[model samples]
Target chain A: MTLNDTDVRAVLHRATDHLSSPDGLVEGVRRGGRRRVARRRLLAGGLAVVTAASVAGVLQFSGTGDERIDVASPLFDEPTRGDLARDPAFLREVTDAWRGATENAELWLRGEPHVVWAGNTPKGKAAYVAQRSLDNPVVVQPEGERLIGYAGFVVPTANGLRVLTFEQFHDSGNLDGNSQAVLLGPDRDTLLVLDFGHPVEYSPSMSYAPDGRIVRQRLPVTFRDGAASLPVPPQLTKVTIAVGRAPMSVDSRIHVVNENEILFPDGKERPEPRRFDYVLPGADRAWGAAVAPTAWPPGAVAALAPFLDSIGTHVVDPEAPDLTVFGATPDGRRLLVSTIQYDDDPGHAVAMLGRGESEYPVVATQPVDWAEPLPVRLRLPDEQGTLVAAPEAKLEYRTGASGTWLDAGRGAALLPAGATDVRVTPASGVARTVRL
Target chain B: MRDVRGTEFDDFVRTRSVSLLRVAYLLTGDRHAAEDLLQEVLEQVYVRWRRVRTTPEAYARRALVNRAANRWRRRARRPESALGDLDPATPDATDDVALREAVVGALRAVPPRQRAAVVLRYLEDLSVAETAAALDCSEGAVKSHTARGLAKLREALAGSGLVVTIPNGSGSSR
Candidate 1:
């Protein structure tokens, strides 16, 4: 039977109808509400004191170190520019500003702030300051000194250089993975991005027109010495910065910026409806790790017990393997599959077919060499067709060797009915055939 | 001291808690988490009682959606629990129970914002404009999120032998 809006609503209501508020709900609300009010009042008073101290230039650096001396670090090794990097007076002003900003912030500076890069852009003069933070409340365990600070641009005003924007950065320790973008400039139209290691390709944003068509636009990024600057449209609120040349590569890191400000335009510009059919839910291995257990079909655990035992306790990870049930055949036989990766061992894909009431036989098991471009193909038992697993690529499959290629969806797909052999093509690789 | 505002807030909670709890349960997919989420949203509503007393439900709903989104993001960052060797016994004898379980499980795969859009638009029977207000996005965004959410739900449900078809112009206002 086909399910529609009414059926979906009915299903949701049925799922939640039995749930009710627990006892003391109201009392709990009142108590928490009162506490929040008290905290807000206390925070307001503290902020007032901080503001006064900042204005008076009496903000004390609490962490251990000489705040006046700029410490040498690998993160701040880049040469400074913009004619102000060598000016001692200007550098001191920027350091004071950094101290004031972090005084009330969660991350406190451990060492003296040093200028990493400074330059004059179309907007104004900006400098990238790098500092060491011993205490980062965000991370659970504070390692040694971590590089954390902000990059700000100052626009010329009647009264000296006014700071237009200050974009904060915290070192995740992964240089190739660090990325951040912010809208700066007086008009809030210049997109400034600080991407370490790899140069940013472009920043793309998606919106929908009134006619329900998806509109995608990419802002080209120009990088000079690690900082990227580009002009962005005023209407766009969110952008995903793609780092590295290969956008779909596993090594590429995509950082989504301004998530809360995401907006869609009205019917001003009509763009063709982008085919979202290739997108699949929970395609990422991380998502599979989280949701796979709850998503397992009935009797699947008992069915795969033998296979699990054969793999031995040492090879089996304490964490669950990423499992996906492609679907069941017309006669109740289900295809169960999982991608298993063990530390210091080669990754492999395991497939099992569940039949009758209590029999699950292993069908196809193949090693997954991630360095290769070929998709992992597992042929089902009894000429049922192949189960294709390619998480990072778009897939297409043809029923017969010479048949037309059809969209195989995103992560996985089962062969069409009565198909003997199938050819699979990945988004980045050449086509290969999996025969039954 | 309990004042008139406190009394009114209490009354609102007493009357609307059941429906609000249901919304939380659907959004969270777990009963205990749902209770915690609803109580948290209600606490925020109580704190802003004077300002949102006239339209408390709308304010509470918007807060619930935003909080759920935040909770999902936090959960994504943490390490996930390992799957047990034994599956929990579920009574799938009845089609209704099976369908309910399928819908809830599928909802877990959807992104938090898209899930909120789907819940508000379908389960709550809200208009596009209402869903937009709750999600703090434009009407067109509401449509896009809902459509994408429905598409994902349909694909997830496909394996369960339950085909979910989106109606033509599903995200049109009301």
Candidate 2:
């Protein structure tokens, strides 16, 4: 029948009830547990499977020439005089200001699992410049009334101050606090963020607006979780300190919904540990010994390298390296993607992600789902570019036609500074019609 | 690792269970798929509770949508489960149960995305902007998806020769 608003609601109610049902909740956890454990083992072991191409031995990056030129971000390519890229002087000034604000912005360092944004001076040069981990990000303008979602990167400038790597639709979408990010007022001290009120208090993802403001802040809270709180200074009552070579910290305030505090250590924030790990049995046959410590650009690999190998004990990868399902899938060989600020980009020279591993230059593709849209420079001829989407879902893809250009997949996943390589892949099996 | 997410998440399941179950059912098309979908979402939520902002329902919903989309991505992925009595807890299901079943039956007649659009737009009552945001597409996409979804829903029902009169107001709307 023509499902009316009520019918629609009824259907949703049914679906949501099913999702939130006791049985459903139990099962979701079971899967997560299984997946997480498997993944952690793979990541730690450091070996994943790789195999020779059936016909062609090599999978070209983005299926394009290795010497591809970096195209201006499609979102900001049309820079008008007043646009961020338009006025040289204004841009320089902002850039310089960003530099000054982030100077001494040591706290902006992006640690894995938990990224912390803190600064010594609120109005100083380093105040807003400390967070370079959350790279180019965009808020989805808050999803369901109850859920607001945002993603970005915090990268440091040459001068050392961290700045929001505002990328993609974020320039247009109102992300509030994070969009119009700048150390404000006198001496450029205040790190201002525009934030919209989310229904829940903590455990939610935070989004920023173009002008460096936090527009939507959904804690995705549950009354049962605990006393609601925000991700602010004092509100950071507790910090999950993963102590190791460096400390990884998270705001305990995020646990506002969970009344009873979960057990995490207190001290210098140590790096967050991998949730799970495993080794692929046929790792040797796939990845040659020369491809030691096989590291692709960010956004590559479906899960832990080893984990994928185990699925079949023989199938190296199903998707392919640097696969941005949304990007150029012409032959589905290569993919291109971006990285986050602090976590991946090592340019800041402030090491994060334990072992100082740069997580950046986001690649494309994932085991679960391929990300939307590929970079402009990386599409194929006929498949050049288009947005592939499911009817009413935010799930979509934009990519090039050819296999030679860069393709960004979903898990290139809004990253932080220290994020690297501009391009990477998830599943190494999926191939593209690589060029050059 | 023993899941530390029990206490709080459990409470969420106890209360919002009705709503969660409903959404799960919508995404998967059957009780079994719905349950499986819900379970998968819950596990993911549990693992990343802190990052997920402690809202089990929110996490569960995101996962459910994602999982449903993943399942749907593979045309081979079809629901193998069946829905029980409409009320779930009670056997009082009647004409409404049949109507609900009919809605789902009609729903399958449409494309997956369109079906989701109808559910999110009309059923979930998601605003145009919110629907687009949740669906992760442009607002234009949401509008188009909704329009197409509604048309397909209508056609599906017509094929079944079932007519559902929509009342303008009153408790019937609920």
Highest DockQ: give the candidate number. 1
TM-score of chain B of 1: 0.83
For each of the candidates, give the backbone clash count: 0, 205
Candidate 2 C-alpha error for residue A273, in Å: 33
**Could you say which candidate leads in lDDT?**
1
DockQ of each: 0.23, 0.20
Predicted complex 1: CAPRI docking category:
incorrect
- lDDT of candidate 1 over A1-436, digit per residue (tens): 3456666676678766655568988877876665454333323222111000001121222453212323333455556644556777777766666555444332334656667555555566555565654432221112332224433333333444543333333333333322244444544566566545444555343333332222344334566665766765552432332324334232453332322233222312223322112213333322233233444544555654433322111222223224354455444465667655433244566676664335555667777665444446676767666676655456566666677877766656666556555455556677666664
**Per-residue CA lDDT of candidate 1, range B103-127, in tens?**
7678888888899998898878889
Candidate 2 at A292: error in angstroms? 35
lDDT of 2 by residue, B30-52 (tens): 66666666666665665566566
